[model samples]
Structure formats: C-alpha cells, structure tokens
Target: MSDTTQMETGRFALNSLKMLLVVGILTLVANSIGPETGFRAGFVESIPGMGLIVLIGLVALLLGRAIPLDLPAFAYAMIIAFALALPFSPVQGPFLGYVERVDFLATTTPILAYAGLSIGLQTGRMKEVSWKLVVVAVFVFFGTYFGSALIAQAVLSAQGLI
Candidate 1:
C-alpha cells in the first residue's frame, strides 16, 4: 500500500478501536443493571453475557482491521456479527437471549450521549450560522423527525403494534 493508504487504514482501525471501547463499556453497564434484578448478584452473573457480546464485536473489528473493506470497520463488524447471530447459526445460542432484553435501550443511551456531546462540541462552528439558516435547519429537523415517526407508525400499525 502507498503511504496515504496506510494512513487511511490506520485511521479506520483507530476509529474501530475507539468504537469498541465505547460500546463495550456501555454494554457492560447495561448488563450490570439487570433487566430483572437492579444490580446485585444478577449483575455479576450477567458479566459473561455482556463480555461475550463485546468479545465478538472485538473479534469482528480485528477481522476488519486485518483486511481492508469497503465498509467502515464497525459496519462490517456488525454484518459479520449478524451473520453469526442468525437463528440457524451455531453461535446464536449464546447471545440471542441476552440481546433480546426489552431494556436494550441502555446501550443506546451512551451512543446517544456521545452524539449529543459531539454536536454540542461544534458550538463554535455553529455560531457562524445565519438566522435564516437556523430556521431552515430547524424545519428540516422537524420534517425528518415527523417523517420518520409517520413511517414507523405505519409500519407498526401494519404489524398490529400500534
């Protein structure tokens, strides 16, 4: 590979490593707060389950790092993980139930928190926005929000979940 290609590969691997760290920490925290028993022996018991998830995710990330891929490391990792998680896949027996928890939102909280902070960190750049631009941005945001909600509602209604 050229110097530029090497640098790009390193950057991708670094980003994937950071993602693994954040996601692993979040997954551990979510598991520690058991769906049934807040945080007692249940948390300790759930360690292996959460660890397994992070472990597989790490393996995927490493696999992506070892070979250049068109997709981002994490994206490729997720596809790899999904393949391993299919119902008929032998690997599914271990993580399927743990991942099925209704409160899986716990893991999402950290990701959302990171997103919010990332946007907030751009406050300096955002100051250059004109009022007109701001108004348009707000409208676009609302439009996307409403559009997604409407689409979700329609899908849920069709599935008798509404």
Candidate 2:
C-alpha cells in the first residue's frame, strides 16, 4: 500500500483504540453504579445513547485527525453550540434528563467541532477570527441544535413514540 494509505490506516486504528478505551472506562463506571441505582429501567435505557455518542465521537476524532484542520477551532465551535443547547435541553423530573442532555452534547459536539475545524483549518484565513464568523457559527450551532430536535420529534411521531 501507498504511504498515505498506510498512514490513514494507522490513524484510524489509533483513533478506534482511543474510543474503545473511553467507552470501556465509561462502561466500567456505569456498571459500578448500576447495582447501586437499583438497575431497574433508567440505567438500561440510557446506556445505548451513551454508546452511540461514543461511537460517533470516535468517528469524528478520526475524521478530524485525517483532515488538515484546527482542533481548537472545532472545540470552540462545539462549546458554543453546547452553551446554546443547554438552556433548551429538558432537565427535570424523575427521569435522568441531565444524563440525556450530556449524551446529546457528546453526540453532537464532535460533529460540530469537526465541521468548524475543517472549515477553519482548510480556509486560507479564518473569517472565524472576525465577529461575523462567530455570530454565524453561533447561528449555525443553534440551527443544528433545533434542527436535530425537529428531526428527532418527527421520527418519534412517525414511530408513535413521541
């Protein structure tokens, strides 16, 4: 195989390993607490989402490394997005709303950051440094947040799960 192909493969492997480590650690923690929490329904329901987020985050990490983009820029964008989504994420009642919100943030943040990082790193100059880009990024972040919510709602509606 060519050098580029080999490098890509190596990077993918490394990223996958990192993701596995993270997931393993998280799972251990969850398992440790599950018995203590009574292990009834709540813990069972939330683990899959947590796993999904970890999987997505791993993919995003690999993609980010493969691309020539700024990691910090991507992180900044995600942080901004998380801030916007926080207030709207339902965190109340008996359900583990806080855990769900955290999972949602985990799933979305990496993707958003990857996007922003790709743009910021590839472009000759960051319009990102300017106030306009910040405003635009914020809007885009909110757009994604709300758009995901709508899509999720539609899916739930179709499934009669809403």
Candidate 3:
C-alpha cells in the first residue's frame, strides 16, 4: 500500500481503538453501579457524557502529540447534542419510558457501532463471507450478558443474597 493509504488505515484503527476504549469504560461504569442504580446515575448524573469526555480527552492527547485530528469533531458534537436532547423530547418519553436510561443507551450506540463496523471492515472477509461471523458476534455478546446475569441471580438465590 502507498504511504497515504497506510496512514489512512492507521487513522481508522486508532479512531476505532479510541471509540472502543470509551465504550468499555462507559460499560464498566454502568455495570459497576448495578442496573437499577446505574439507570438512575446515567440520566440524572450524566453518565453518558462520561464517554464523550474520554473521547475528547483522547483527541486532545493525540493533538498534543502532533497527530492529525482524523475524526470529525463537529459530527461528534452533533451526536453528543442529539444524545443529550433526544430522551428529553416528549415523543421519546412514551416509547422508552425511562428517559435517562434510554438516553444513556442511545448515546452509547455510536461507539459500539463504530467498534463493530471497525471489526467487520478490518477482517477483510466480510465482503465475501456469509452471515456466520455477524451472527456469532451477536450471539456471543448476548450470551455473555445473559449468562452473567443468570449466574449472578442463581448465586444470589442459593445464598439468599436476593
């Protein structure tokens, strides 16, 4: 590949990595507080914006080190604004029920989509492959979350922790 192509590829990888880091950290914070409390903490306390902070921080660090701003700042700003505003709208209130919780998840989707797209693109086989890997990833993600919740509930039941 040409130098420019290599640079573009590197930029894509770096952005994807940064997005993944933000999502992972957001997930950790949400999970640590437990579901009920996390839902409260997210909307009332700005838990979703935590991911934005991490993204901007990473960008600033990259700029300080002389890395070009490959990611579009305005696009992210619009996303953040939309994320912060959508749940508060009356239309979404009836459908989602919990404005804060729904907003938090809504905000988190961009990064998750970015990560998933990065994976699907970088594999170089998505264009030729059947739906196998996509199906597998979906199942794996669901399985891990469901399995953990089930195990936790079982342990709590056995120990009377519930």
Candidate 4:
C-alpha cells in the first residue's frame, strides 16, 4: 500500500478506537444506575463512583504506558483499581461507601462487550489452533473453578466457618 493510504488507515483505526472507548465510557456512566433506587436518583448518585473508576483506570493506563512493561493495559488498570480498593488504601476512603450501591451488573455490559471485541479480533489465530483452543479453554475454566474453590475452602476452614 502507498504511504498516504497507510497513514489514512492508521488514522481511521485510531479514530475507531477512540469512538469505541467513548461509547464504552458513556455506556458505563449511564448504566451506573442501580435497580433498587430507580433511574433518576441512582443516575445522579452513581456519577462520582463511576468517575473515580474511570479516573483510576485512566491513571493506571497512563502509568503502564509510561513504564517499559510487557503487560497489557487492562492488567495494570485492574491492579491499580484492586490496590486502591484494598482496606488499607487511604485512596478508597469516600468511594467505598458509594460502592455498595454501585450497579456492577450494569458495568459488566461494556466490559464483556470489549472482551468479545478482543476475542473477535483474534479469530484467525483461534481457528488455526482449532480443537486445541477448546482443550485449553476447558483447562482454564476448570483450573479457575477448582483453584478458587480450593482457596475458598481453605480460607473458610481456617476461619472455622465451613
């Protein structure tokens, strides 16, 4: 392809990514409403929590980009969010109170949508793996399931709650 054509394609791809992210952000913001509180009141209340999540995720992404790490952006974003949400983190002070009423079911919509988009982009490579992909997927599923169950059982046993 010509240089001009390549540049145009790159521009188009960047614009497309920006558009998708904007839509996802908007969807997450709007869907922040809780079922228990109804739309109007919950919509107003959820904004701060949603804002904090997006800010933290954006900061994480920026930090990841600044560093010379091989990890994916989402991994860093998750780690930053998780760390901030930890009990000892002073950063989570006000946000924790709002967290309980935050509509996580609504938040999953864009997250799953992006996950689908990511998987869809790898279709050809997935087809190359074929049945082996299924085997790997099954192993991943069982590993996660049983691993979590084992941890939970251990923790519960230690606590004498099980």
My TM-score estimates for the predictions, one after another, are 0.61, 0.33, 0.29, 0.58
Model 2 over residues 1-162: C-alpha lDDT tens digits? 124645565767686767665653455444434434433224456665455445545655555566565564346435443543565555322223323423333334445655797887667665438888779989999999999999999999999996
Q: Candidate 3: lDDT over CA atoms? A: 0.57
Across 13-131, the per-residue lDDT of candidate 4 in tens digits comes to: 56645654575456556565435543322656666666666666666655555566667667886888788779999967676665544565676767687789899778878767779
- TM-score between candidate 1 and the true structure: 0.61
lDDT of 4 at 100: 40
TM-score, cand. 3: 0.29
Order of candidates by lDDT, top first? Answer: 1, 4, 3, 2
Model 2 lDDT, full chain set:
0.55
- Which has the better lDDT: candidate 1, or candidate 4? 1
Error of 1 at 2 (Å): 9.2
Clash count list over all predictions: 0, 0, 0, 0
TM-score-based ranking = 1, 4, 2, 3
Deviation of model 2 at 31, angstroms: 7.5
| Among all candidates shown, the one with the greatest TM-score | 1
- After TM-score superposition, what is the CA distance of residue 120 in candidate 2 from its true location, in Å? 34
Give the higher-lDDT candidate: 2 or 3. 3
lDDT, model 4, position 108: 72
- Against the reference, the lDDT scores of all candidates come to 0.67, 0.55, 0.57, 0.66
lDDT of 3 by residue, 1-162 (tens): 124544454576588567657664655455445555445444334444454445654544444334454655545544544554586765444323433443455445566767898897668876666699789889999999999999999999999989
- Cα deviation of 33, candidate 2, in Å: 2.3
